[model samples]
Target chain A: MEATLGIEGGATKTTWVVLDAEGRVQATGRIGPGNVSLLREEELRALLAAIRTETGGQFHSIGAAFAGCHLAAQRERIAGLLRVFWPSAKRVVVAEDAHSAFAGAFGSGEGIVVIAGTGSNVRGYREGRWARAGGWGHILGDPGSAYDLAHIALQRVYDAFDATEGLVPLGESFLERTGQKDLEELFVYIHSDPSKDRIAALAPCVLESAAAGDRFAVDVVLSRCGLLADQVKCVAEKLRFDRPKVALVGGLFEHSEAYALLFEEQVRSRLAVSTVFVSRVPGAVGAARLADEAAEEHPGVEPKPSRILLRESATSLDGALTEERNPRSRFLDRKSVPELVELFLAEERLVEEALRERKEEIAAADRKSSYAVFCLKKK
Target chain B: MEATLGIEGGATKTTWVVLDAEGRVQATGRIGPGNVSLLREEELRALLAAIRTETGGQFHSIGAAFAGCHLAAQRERIAGLLRVFWPSAKRVVVAEDAHSAFAGAFGSGEGIVVIAGTGSNVRGYREGRWARAGGWGHILGDPGSAYDLAHIALQRVYDAFDATEGLVPLGESFLERTGQKDLEELFVYIHSDPSKDRIAALAPCVLESAAAGDRFAVDVVLSRCGLLADQVKCVAEKLRFDRPKVALVGGLFEHSEAYALLFEEQVRSRLAVSTVFVSRVPGAVGAARLADEAAEEHPGVEPKPSRILLRESATSLDGALTEERNPRSRFLDRKSVPELVELFLAEERLVEEALRERKEEIAAADRKSSYAVFCLKKK
Candidate 1:
């Protein structure tokens, strides 16, 4: 019996399932916080070991969907890790979450898949090419994301309170909730840590309260939905797929009635998109199918790892460290200017400048001093 | 019978309840993210109405924990809002969360409270006076917060991955979770959003994986714990709190099993006169009680707010908004010389000279400019 494997990895959790060739889930194991970037080799190995032990059955092939696993080096390292454990398994493949999400949404053909979870991103697949929009994290990007909508609402409400504008029920509710004696405390709280996404998560409750007839809460919700619609417009523009069958995947779209209604209404009103998919499909399922495709095409060919290997790979999947340059690990190695810039920027001086606007002035001054003589006379 | 209210309001969520004065939670209702700074007046009024509906009983006197209520202006606004709602409530008072947490811990006495939730702050209170350490945002501070821990882990793992150091399991796991494909992808993800607290939340998982023998994860966790301990020690040293019982509050310390243990062990090992108290007392309870204390002590006294209402507060919360100030708003406000210097220093032009490595060359250029000015004056 060929053992089957299923993997569900997300920002919050990672789950793996072993299935027989017939597709019955034979064994399943779960691990905490499975984003590989956040895990160490020992932890990864331990998690992998847990799965390997639970499944026991040696599988003929392995398919994995990694959260944030779009890089080639990451795929190679993951493949090497799987190769160690399933030595007999001829094929191991990894692909972007978007690919898997696309597959899960349309199965085989072309369509647009929008993922809105803790973060947000939209991917369009046409003519075997993929174009992505948004998902730029909760900061600079993530336009129509839950975090974005919630952040905008919160900011507007806060602005109203600061202005001492007329009474808003949600603002009053906010005062009651924070238990802050006044505006000063609220500002401090907002200034403190400031998780816009976490704040955004509470958006659903606001919408619910509004639908139940709280004018203030409703206003906030409407404002939030409008902001989300604006973000969707940006993505639609980028992908150039107007009126495409858009599948909505994320807790916000799935749960919030007010937001969903408002979002759909706004999209129809604002953009000339043909179809809006309200279908629920997991990104993980999409990721799994993408892996299956990669495996079929590549067969036994595992790309060389670029420069980084997972901790899990060290112990179970990839096995012993090679003092010499291992052919398999080479694919994980590549250098980029931006990557180098990031390193240089890590120095305290650069980090300080990045953190504070004024610090850049100081850095510029120091630069001028060093180059003053050089400018006067060629170096 | 007087109504009793249970309110839990922070930067994240808000809750309000009413019970008889005998202290039984009666009716309960929750509204969406209610930070006053983020709400409009309409939203505030609507949300407050919902709370009133949930109570179903008249609140003779109510209590709440509010976020960013530390400012005098904010306090007056909240008082005004509350007055509008429960007109005949015998009394109302507001105070800071530090005071609330202190009261919750000692109930009117003095102790140390270390909070490590979305942000990290340590406050030492003794006989009404308070001292604080490290509650800056992810941009500046939050040394021991979950965000801080996660940020440090990301940095370390990335450094290790890039370095020629022997690969570890934690490194591998990190790669698996991030799916960076390679260094370039990893760089992009790190630069995206790059929240310190979200990163800190991932520490526990690293700790868990490390304990199971993920060496890389273990190293990261140990280093993070060390940083946290250092933060506690820095505050302890600054304010000579001899054998003070440091009450640990916040999700990071409360939820992470080994993290608390490791933190406590590290602190004890380093400080000769320090005791760590893992308390169950919630900050909200403390905040409510603090409000009661403030009400009792102040009697009928209420602050007369400055004239600078919301219209004049159009800039960022850090007091950058000067464009909207009217004569009335600017009436009593005066900037100190030091404050002016600080503001001036914030200008991008002034700080550039200091950025260069050769300060003397810049100084020479300045001297030449001064000489030219002299010559111009002579002419």
Candidate 2:
């Protein structure tokens, strides 16, 4: 029996759907954090197995879109994994989740898409060329994103407490939310590996309060939306798009209408020509479409362009590029592709280290590990 | 602003009640398995803290009744702990949980009471004298207890799979429950510490099938009940109360009426008991009542009894004593109590060894270090 599998890897959740030839989902499986930047390859494979179990078997072809998986190297790594998991399959396709969100939002057309969950990013496409905005680490950017909103709200709450010299009612509320005793503890918690994302998720609750006329919280939300608009503006200006069509695709948009509307108002107010639209089709469906496109483009490649067996040559080229600095080339081109790739690879390592630290903090959490997982803040 | 605290410690749960001096419970706390045979004194303190957190605070004049708290040395150790927790309180009482159950069942009167949860035991009282039957360690006894039923079920399931000389349906079912591929994997998991308790819990689910009259499961339950009845018979025969009043307590009574009726009928058929009663008052309450009695019996004693505290001590002691040679003679025997107490001083080296082993396990638990006052079990 022929099957099509679509996987959507998010900062907080990895969702996958198995469809029969007719494109109707037979089963769906959901788990947390599948981005290789955040999860080990073995962890990703376990998630795939969970999907397979939910689907009842292996599929004929698969399409997977991942957050923080834009690099060509990651695509090849995933392709190899798919081959092992689906040896008899016809094809496999792997790509950046932005592409999936873009397709889901605008199909084959040119447009920009914004996604915000534990992390946030904006991507623009024009005739197969890609440009991007925001999604810098939590320390630098991600305004209007869940992480951005949460970060801002936490600061404001702390600021208010500090302003009152710790006499503020909100200090107790924050303590209740994080289960920490004071600012020092909260700092340790935030910087600790696997930082709590759910604490940041409370940004929406704060946003809701602001919408209900809580001036302090509303200011936090407004500032967050303004920052997100500025990020989108930066991408549009760089790409030289007169009136780039904007599409929103993420939990930040799908779950919160207030945040979406506020973001749209801010972006349109800043840029005259752009029109933002939220995507109706999910990212997984977009991945499925991309898989179909890849198969169409490369029809007769050995093992098929879209199919991969996970067991074949279990290692990949990424293993070779470790810390043996290309000293000669480091002096050659400062902004070369190799340099960019190395930076991402280094970032992946940093992210892994951070996640490990987060895991330790959460491992000590009694009975509710999921809550710790939910609480993790993605940069 | 003053309060009265009551505690009852049994095989299954150590319960604590804080009342506002009017005998109305202000807060209630429950902890499982207060048997000193299983928990070290330090482990007991942690359990007490858990109950204290649940109960909200310290209270005046606490009463505690503990299981397996027979020896004078054990009582003195418990007395010291109560004094520390309730120093400002007017009174503290400590006694055996059986007496409290007796009071709750047939207050201030003679009767027989059977208790079962993780372990099973029967206690009979006639004119202030008490006798106990069963409640040995899981390896030695504990028939009609959840632990015994669970143990038997596990063995049957294992034996059934082995008899097939390969994989059986039961093996497949067990694999499904544990998400394991086969018996070999299951066996490895069964040996894992946390895994044992999780698998044992599944046994009760199997008992539900037996209650519905699955022949194999029925036999398991009946055999367990028979063992329980035998324990009760030992105490009843010794007390020589022909037509003695009997009361039932614990999880077995609460969960399965059929099992309880069968046990009652078997006891009646064998021992010619006139009245069989089920106690609605919890064992913790009974323990508290006994604690009250103890403090009153010995006034100006610094330590006051706490229902939840002593049980925690008992559990900690049990975990500590697992590897130690029987020191029953050191603590038992009233005539030699002074000599034995002096020997304890002489054998301070042995006590030190036990404390080290306990510290190792606590360290291995790898969480926050806990505080405890007594050391009974070692590595």
Candidate 3:
């Protein structure tokens, strides 16, 4: 019997599932962030090979969604690597993980999926169209995300401190959670080696504080949720979703039932959002479905241009020039060829910095890959 | 004529003025941050020797205000270094640089000084008593500071981005100012090696954007100034100064005439402020006056306990374990002897981290000190 494999890579961990032709889960495997953008070509190859070994079976179809796989060129490159890893696979597809998230949220149905986990993004599908808001990242976007909640809360604490309202309950809770003795140590704990997931890890404290009537924390969460509601509204308006069904997916919503309810109330008030539900479908399952669809498609259809979606872990792209589009994408439409080339060159300069920042993760992955790759190649 | 020297050390640089007994400036010299807390014992001694060499003359009195000299023990340690540098000086005193700023702002008179530079503080004096608000540092306090302005502006930009308000004029200006091409690059520009002064440097962009009529930027500055106004009132109420004089000191006020005007408008509307003026008296000059006063004081009059004032650059204290008092100070009066010792030991672990961070500055000073100390010894 023919089978299909689907992979979903994230900042914290990478997971994949194998499905028999009948669409039943045949096997599952997990590993570190075998991510798209940060890995060198060889490392990526090693990761894919290891995945195949874990499945311990041949596949005729594959769909892989990795963070940092933004452009058609990137997707095609990943597809080529998969072909080499699983030579028997006749159909292969690779896309940015956001697609998998959307697939996970609503499958083939039309609705908006708000992914506000380690990073954040909002993507909607309706009538064969996709619209999105706030998938940019923590730096200039992703407001109302877990990172935003924690960051704004810190700002409020600092601002409150100026009014001689020093170290309110919210700030004190953060100090306790992080095992930070004082504000100075907390600052070091954050800025010294800031990570998106790591900072977002502190969001639960803000939620806990707000739940317990910490005024500042409440304000922080409410304001962020308001922004997030606006984000949903933007996608709703853009996609013209009449009474849109929304899936509030991420660690944040899962961490606190009160937080999820608060966010739902906000979005419901701001947007006539019809349905709000925490996502139950795993992104890897959506990838498997996508794999199934790809295998069944007629060979004549030109591969559709993958729509832009946010990576699972935007922090993986920190210091990384996250080039979403190549010269062909809409982002480069206004630029002259030379200007576009120059833009790419400027991004190239920052690539090494990103690689260096991710060196530890790469080294750790390399250690795991060595044994895994050797075993897979022998098979 | 008897001679006296005054030294004021900030995060960016240190300056000293040798004053004649009549309070005329005889000579002035400047160098890099001869900070207190970050410096090791030998490094502090070396820095003092360098200052003495630059003075090129013997002094009867010396008074120094250095960032990080918070505790009585730290002040005494600095005084001992100064004594070694100026062996013939009859009187030596040391204090935190905030005192120098307060002395600079009001001299011997009683008034409130609002310092909203890279970091911030509000200190008011009345009848030999001092009251302070908001000198805590950027992590927990120092709102209305330059760093706060820049940071808050960025947060607004991020929140706005969720609603498709990405890279507003204020954020664009920050990118232009930092020479970053995009938001992700700007994040790297900030978090890669976050520093208080470095982040504070972005404040002018927000100020400029506000001047240019960017609504968010305008709100950021206005709100921050309003906070600064409240801070002034806190100090004023605490010290019970009737229609007290307020000095708007620091780079924020110095950077823009309109900003200072806006701040004054807020404070005047909130409090029955008698006078608000930009400070012209440099902290070094205030330190010079303090030196002269020390030289003239009777031997029986104990050197007064140094009052807490905000540092000239609070960034120097970032990531540092800033201990403000030893067992003797009023701060520790309520604590048991055992608790005080335990607290000091807890701080010892952080001391090494601070030292590691300041190693480059120490090395830079050591090179300069070797030549300077040799010349001074020969004299």
Q: DockQ (Cα-based) per candidate?
A: 0.06, 0.01, 0.15
Name the candidate that leads on TM-score. Answer: 3
lDDT of 2 at A36: 58
Evaluated at residue A40, the lDDT of candidate 2 is: 80
TM-scores (chain A) of the candidates: 0.66, 0.68, 0.75
Ranking by lDDT: 3, 2, 1
What's the residue-level lDDT of B85 in candidate 2? Answer: 61
What TM-scores do the predictions have? 0.43, 0.38, 0.66
lDDT of 1 by residue, B1-379 (tens): 5554445566666655443443333344456656565566787677666766666435555455555444566656666676677666655555445455555555544456767676666666653455565453443355556666655555555434323333355545555677755544645666554654345546565655654655555555556566556656655665666776566666666555445555655566667533354443444444444444343523223211111111111111111111122342242135432232223223323334322333443234323433432332232
Misplaced by over 4 Å in model 2 are A1-3, A19-27, A50-61, A88-91, A166-194, A295-379, B1-379
Say which prediction, candidate 2 or candidate 3, comes out ahead on TM-score: 3
Global lDDT of model 2: 0.56
Candidate 1 interface RMSD, angstroms, 1 decimal? 11.2
- How many backbone clashes are present in model 3? 0
Computed on C-alpha atoms, the DockQ of candidate 3 is 0.15
Please tell me the interface RMSD, in Å, for model 2. 25.8
| Ranking of all candidate structures by their TM-score, best first | 3, 1, 2
